[model samples]
Every structure is written in C-alpha cells, then in structure tokens.
Target chain A: MVMSWIWTGIVLLSILCAAATGKGGQLSSAAMQGAQAGVTLAVSMAGAICLWSGVGKLMAVCGITGALSRRMRPLLVRLFPSAAADVSLAGDLSANICANLLGLGNAATPMGIRAAKRMVRGDIATDELCRLVVLNTASIQLIPTNVAAVRSAFGCTAPFDILPAVWITSALSAGLGVMAAYLLGKVRRG
Target chain B: MTDYIVPILLFLAAAMALRRKENAYDVMLQGASEGLKLLVSILPALILLLTAVYMLRASGAMELLSQGLRPLFALLGIPPETAMLVLVRPLSGSAALAVGADLMAQYGVDSQVGRTAAVMLGSTETTFYTISVYFGAAGIRKTRYAIPAALFADLVGFCMASLTTRLFFPE
Candidate 1:
C-alpha cells in the first residue's frame, strides 16, 4: 500500500523536478535507461542468485543451514515468533542473517527471498514478516568490506579506523529499527 | 581470507553432503530451480523500483531534494556537503556509493565529512530497495508499517553515523 505511494512519489517528483528545471526532455530517456538497467541487473542477478541459492539449498539439505538457524534461534524467537515457529522459515531467516553478517551479500538475498516467501500468510504482511524485512534493512555488519575498499581506494591511511564507528551505528540502527517495528506493528495490529 | 570464505563454505557443504550419502548434484539443482522461481517474483519489483530510482537520479531530482534538505540535515550534525548520502542511501545502493565516493574524492577520505559518509553507508540499509525486493518476493502487497518504521530507523542511523564519527575521531 505504502509502496505504491512511494513509487508514485519518486516518479512524479522526478518528472516535476525535470519540468521545473527545464530538463523535461531528459525524463523519457532517463526512464527508458532505468528500465534497461533493471533488465540487465536482473539478468546478471539471475546467475549469481541462483548459484547461491543452489549452494544454499545444498547446505540446507546437509543440515548446515539448520545448525546456523539453531544458533540464532533464541534471538529470532523473540523477534519473529510466528516465523520462528516453523523450521524452514526460521532456517532461511538464520541463513540470511549469517550471510549478511559475513558481508556475503550475494549469498544473502536468495535465503532472504526464500524466507520472505514463506512468511506470506495472506495478502497483507504479518508483523513477523515486517520485522524480518526491518532486520535485513538494519542488518549489523561484521565487516564493512565495501566501505573499507572505497576508503582504501581513496587512500585513507587507516581505512579500517571507521570500523568502530560502523559497528556502533549499525548496532544502534538495528536495535532501534527492531524496536520501532515492534511498537509500530503492535499499534497497527491491535 | 575474505576471498576464500565462499569456496570454503562450498567445500564444507559438499563434504557434508557426501558423508551423508545425499545426491549433492540433484539437491543443488533443486535449490537453483526454487531460487529461479523466486527471482521471477522479485524481478518485476526490482525493475520498477530501479526505474524510479534511476529516473529520479537522471532527472537530478535526488540532488535537488538532497540540497533542499541540507539545512535540516545540518541541524542533526550531518555535514552539509554529503547531505545527498543520507537522502539517496535508502533509495539506491549504487547511487549512495557514488555519493560516498564523490564525498571522499572532493574532501579527502580522512576528512570529517568523508568519514561520516563512509560510516553512514556502512551502517544503514537501503530501505526502499530491501523492502520492495523482500516484500515483492513474498507476494505481500500491503506493507502497512514496515516502510515508516524502517525509514525512521534510517533517519536515526544517519544521525548516529555523524554522531559516532565525531565521538570517535574528535579533532
């Protein structure tokens, strides 16, 4: 529901801005370019995401994913009680979090999608599913690899010096995001 | 070490499957197929969102909005120059990266604004991108409060990045 509006907002705002700036001629080209980029992105993602999903599946069958999720069970139970009630749903959630923690972003999305798919109980999203999305959005990073790379590329002497700041800010965001989702979700569900 | 993580994980999974006497090849294929199906559900959302994000970027709207929001962002201690990072970080990943990289380029990576931009990128998630992909895959059309809550957290995360950077790297 909100997504529809947000999507509209961006497109409409972009057109309005373009017109106001007299860049109206650029809007069509921009929209088409974006569409083309999305197609390319999806095509590239298909290969990597599927391979990771395959590997992820093998891990699931071998019980490694199950073990990983088991480790995250206590925490997940409190955050996603409804989804946690199911084995595979919790498993995918656990796997997704673990991958994100390691900064294995390519490996995380497939599990995230799998878990999210299972979270669908009806047309509307449940509180637990919303929490899952919230958690992913605020996932704490054990290694800010991409940021470090960018810093080093720019010749920052102590690239990793930002590690401490990253950890604190990410932890704060993740905690606050979870809390916000919980409180807000309760109000809505009630 | 970081580069070897994926291969090592694959090795462990394969080893375990062999020991368990399971057909690893078939299992992998099954997983791949399921994932492929899930991607079908996610691709449309990705395309639409990306289109909007790219359109917004190309039209210079994001920059304009970011510029307009600089004053408000400054009130929260965020550097006025990297105001665009806080604005676009939630909407698009690559765009945020460009903003962060641009900040580092323009103001030396070791500078205050540069450090804050890097930390902000590392700490916060791409909210709209994640929500759309996750919810779209799940076939959940009506995301009641998730967007508001996540965006709120993002706002705080951006402020905290500025705050923590100042606290840790005081001049």
Candidate 2:
C-alpha cells in the first residue's frame, strides 16, 4: 500500500541524508532512540485509551450513548445519508464525534473503527466510510487539551489563548474536508 | 479551563451509569480489556510510524527537507521554521507537539512563530495514524479518496493557522 512505500522512503531517505551529511553514527543512535521513544509513546497512550474506552462502555451500558445518538441522528443523517437507517452505525458515529470533540483522539479511535467497520461495503470503502474518516481527521477540538497542555508545560501564561484561531482553522478544515469527500464520492460514482 | 472538560465528562458518564443501575464496574472492566487489546493490535503500526518519524527528525533529514521547502512555505505565509511541524503534524501528534514545543522554546512562546505553531498543532489531527487504525480495524484494503481528502484538509489547516495567527497575534 501507499503507507508501505512512505515508510520505506522515510527510512531510506534518513539513511541517505545521514550518509550525505556525514552523520551515519548519529543516524544509528537515532534509530535506536526513535524506537525507544515509540515504545514510551505507546505506553503513555495506553492508559488514556483504557480509561476512556471504559467510560465509553459505561455510557453505552447506561443508554447514554443511545440518547446521544438519537439527539445527533438528524445531523448524522445529513452527513452520512447512506448510514441513516442503521441505528448502531449512527450511535457509533455519534460516540466517535463526541469523543473527538472532547479532544479524546485515543479514546475516539475504537468508536471510529466500529463505525467504519459497519460502513464498509466489501473491499471498497463506502462514501459514508470516507466521510467518516475525513470528519475524524479534521475533527474540531473544542478543548484541544493536548496542545493546551503542551503550551502550559512550555510556560505559556495563557495556554488557551489560541482558542479562537484553533476554532477558525479547525472549522474550515473540517468543512472543506466534508465538501471534498462529497465531491470525490460524486466523482467516483460517476 | 479546557483542561477540566475530559475529567468532568468522565465524572458525568460515571454518575449516569451508576444511577442507571447498570453494572458499571463489569462493563468498565470489559471495555478496558477491549481497549488494551486494541492498543496491542495497533502498537506495531504506531511504533513503525513513530520510529520513522523520529529517525527522520534525529537524522536531520526533516530539517534538510524543511530548509528545502522553506521557500514554498514562505510563499504560503507560513514561517520557514514551521515547515517541519506542518509536514509532521499529519503523521504523528506527539512528534508534532515535540516540534511545536521546540519552536516555542527557541522562539519566545509569545512570538508569532510560536503562536502559529500552537494553533497549527491544536487544529490538526494525526491523519496517517487515524487512517491506519480505522481502516486497519475495518479490514479495508482500498482507501479510495480518504488520504487525499485528509491531506487537503491538513493543507487548509496549515494555511488557516498561519493566516489566523497573523491576524489575531499580529507582530
């Protein structure tokens, strides 16, 4: 797939650049350090994902997700017309969006996967699937907790000072993404 | 203020579950276990992507690429230093945060470049990671237009981040 080529190209290019720059020694160390960093990142993310996923399940068990899905159904239908009739798909999509809106990217993945699985119509991705991916990719983060946390950690006096900018950019990106997907879907169909 | 949203929502969800008389503890355990499984499933891809990203940065390849792309980024109104963060934003979230933090430290946190990087980081999602996890879970081979569309959105985000930073945080 495209990802394979991208991975290979990055690794190859890293080695090539290091050799060209006479930093081969540094490159070797970087490779090891990079792998170690990856493990640490994953382990850190695991805790957040576990807690949120558990919370998500509790929401479902208590019918909170169902009520949320119902409240969101009209908007979901507009966004994903193909998935309108499927209640579970709507529920999953709503839950995914809710998590994403809260800036819970790690927590949102499981629900996103579940929604995507339901929307896949065989080997090819359905229009709904593509839309969902696009939406998730450009999701508007009302909280943007990670970015704010980083800014605060870096000693920014007003970590959330960029909220307006974040709102504008995210809204534009998500709006354009949905538009692009819809147009692409039309092109693909025709 | 934004930092408390997640904890508040978590508390509300827990309170609701308890009031509903649903065995919240058992359901939570099941979901937590499922989450652990999901984490294990996606770890390989995540690690591979992260390692590649880190290696690219550590090898100075990213800097070279950013320098090479500086002119084009400048033409688009983005600070030359942010070219690397913009490119890396869609690939990995933590990596982008590292780059953003580095920028903030190098330039004063209130500097235009710093604010721009912050907005860019806040607005964008980890596009490649999302695709891999969602599509991998669904067992879909063909991504169709999702990648291109997502990248397009990221591009818009980058532009808007720069533009808004200039407008709202004028130098």
Candidate 3:
C-alpha cells in the first residue's frame, strides 16, 4: 500500500509538472489520443494472449505439449535439476519459460500458474518456489512478442531492431538469475 | 475493409479449425479459470504507473532528466535525441521505434547515433510499465531489487548494444 501511494504521488507530480511547463497542455490532445491508443493496444494484446493460450491448451489436450515435453525433458531436467522426474512441476515451468521467451506471456502465465500450483501440490519447498520465481523473472526471451507488438502498435516498420540487444541482455540476466537462485538455494533460511 | 480481410480470414479459419476439435475448448477453459486474481491485483499498479509517466512527460521533468544525462549519452556514443527516445519508448513502444527510424533516416543508419538508437531500441525493457504490471499481477509486495536490477540490466543492454554494433557494423 505504501508503494502504491508512492506511485500515485509520482504520477501526480509528473502531471502537475507537465501542466505547469505548458508541455502538458501542448500535448493534451496527443496524450488523450495516446490514452485511447494505449487502451486499444492493451485490449488487443490481452485478446491475442488469450487466443494463444487457447491454442496452447488445444495443443496440451491433443497430447502435443506432452509430446514436446517428452522430447525436451532431457534438456529441461538439466536446466531445472530439482524438479521431479518426468511429468513434474519443473518440466511445466520449463514449458512456461519457453513460452515466455517466445513472448507468449499470456499463454506462459497460465503455464506458469499451473506449474506453480503443481509445485505447491507436490509440497515443493519455498526455496524452490523462489528459485522458480527468479527464473521466471529472468526468463530469457528471443522473440519478445510483447515488445515487438508494442513497437508495431506504435507504427514502427522495423520492430526487430531491438532483437540483438534483447538477446544479449536477457541471456546475461537469466544467467545471473540462475546463479543467484542457485546460491540462494544453498543459503536461504528456508 | 480490404486491408483487414487477411487478418479476419486467418482468425475465422483458425476458429473453424479449433471448433472441429473438442480438446481445444477444454484446455482453454482450464487455463482461463486461473490467473484472474493476479490480473486483478495489478490493475491499480498499471493505472499508477501510467499516471506517473504522464506526469513526468508533462512537468518537463523528463526533459531535465534527459539534459542532465547528455554527457553520459555522449560517452556511450548515443545521440542526444535518443534520450527522448529511450524515455518515451517504454511508455509507448511504437513512438520510440518511430523516433529511432526517423533518426536513422535523418542521420543515416551507419552513423554512430543512428546505430546506437537501433541498439537501444532492441536492448532495453519497458522498465516502469513492466515493473508495475508484473509486480502488480504477482502481488509482489516488495520489489527490493527488481527496479534497480532491471535498470542495471538496461544499462548493460545499452552498453552491449553499442559495443556489438561497433564490432559488427564498424565504420
């Protein structure tokens, strides 16, 4: 709640400053348009994500996800050693991570939730949950559909300009995240 | 109407295909039933983040923030205009990309600034928006290091983008 209040204050401060400096009024029309545009974009994104989740679910029901999971299990197990063998929460987490990297957050979020729920059902330790959280946060994405979608939403012809940069940064961040998670796993009070 | 035809047709076809399959419907229902709480939790955070961004852009604070950071920009081979681009991109991704393209077209993509802008475009995440939304959705009460960590990652991204461009696209 404190953070929420602080955030609110910052918004008010930015608005007030913009208005006084005349930039606020200058861009009043554009800002209004932007708000409309932002809403449209957000809604579209939400819809797109929902669609993807549906497709993913279809894939799962058809045994596609399981098939893919089986193929990926070896590599996935290495990535998430603590996860139970075959048909485990860690495997689901890896699928979610994969989806997130592809910029399917909507789809990935569900998978992630499922994974977390499964982990909880398995009575996974808090430490593993935290590690999964870190991994999710640090999940290295390649396509960055959300970012690219945002770029396209704004009308850029070349959304992939940021691809290389995203790749490098995410890879490093994920590497660091995994290391940190591993270290924390070793030392956490839990 | 014609311009929208392709997307419309694609969706219709996909829907038709899905309708023929029973499994698709079940999977959709199962996943949709969850994550609603997380989505609800973060709505306020988004509203607040947007308000803050609006305020910063309004008060001329970002301009000041930009001006103060010019020297650092120059050191990284970043064009002055990119300050505005980076500042705006997170709030509105398309606007930032447009700015980057304009800079490239104006200065030639081979120019240091143009390339830097390109790299910048790819490298950084929408910091404030992302932090607000993700943290909000997850009900993450404490973001002890997420902000700093993300920004630090952005900084690293900025540096790497420039470095890689120079190495690969060397003049």
What lDDT score belongs to each candidate, Candidate 1 first? 0.85, 0.85, 0.58
What are the per-residue Cα lDDT tens digits for candidate 1 across A74-170?
9988887865569988888889999888887768988987778787888798888888888888858788889999999998778889988998888
TM-scores for all candidates: the values are 0.95, 0.94, 0.68
Interface RMSD of 1: 1.4
The predicted structure with the larger DockQ, 1 or 2, is 1
Please list all clashing residue pairs in model 2, or write none if there are none: none
Give the runs in model 1 whose Cα sits over 4 Å from its true position: none
By TM-score, the best candidate is 1
For residue A51, give model 3's deviation from the true position in Å. Answer: 0.2
Question: Which stretches in model 3 have alpha-carbon errors above 4 Å?
Answer: A1-9, A12-16, A19-38, A67-82, A85-88, A103-106, A113-139, A143-166, A177-190, B1-22, B29-42, B75-81, B88-102, B109-111
Q: What CAPRI class is candidate 1?
A: medium
Q: Each candidate's root-mean-square deviation in Å? A: 1.6, 1.8, 6.1
Give the B-chain TM-score of model 1.
Answer: 0.92
TM-score winner between candidates 1 and 2: 1
Ranking by DockQ: 1, 2, 3
- Tell how far residue A6 is off in model 1, in angstroms: 1.5
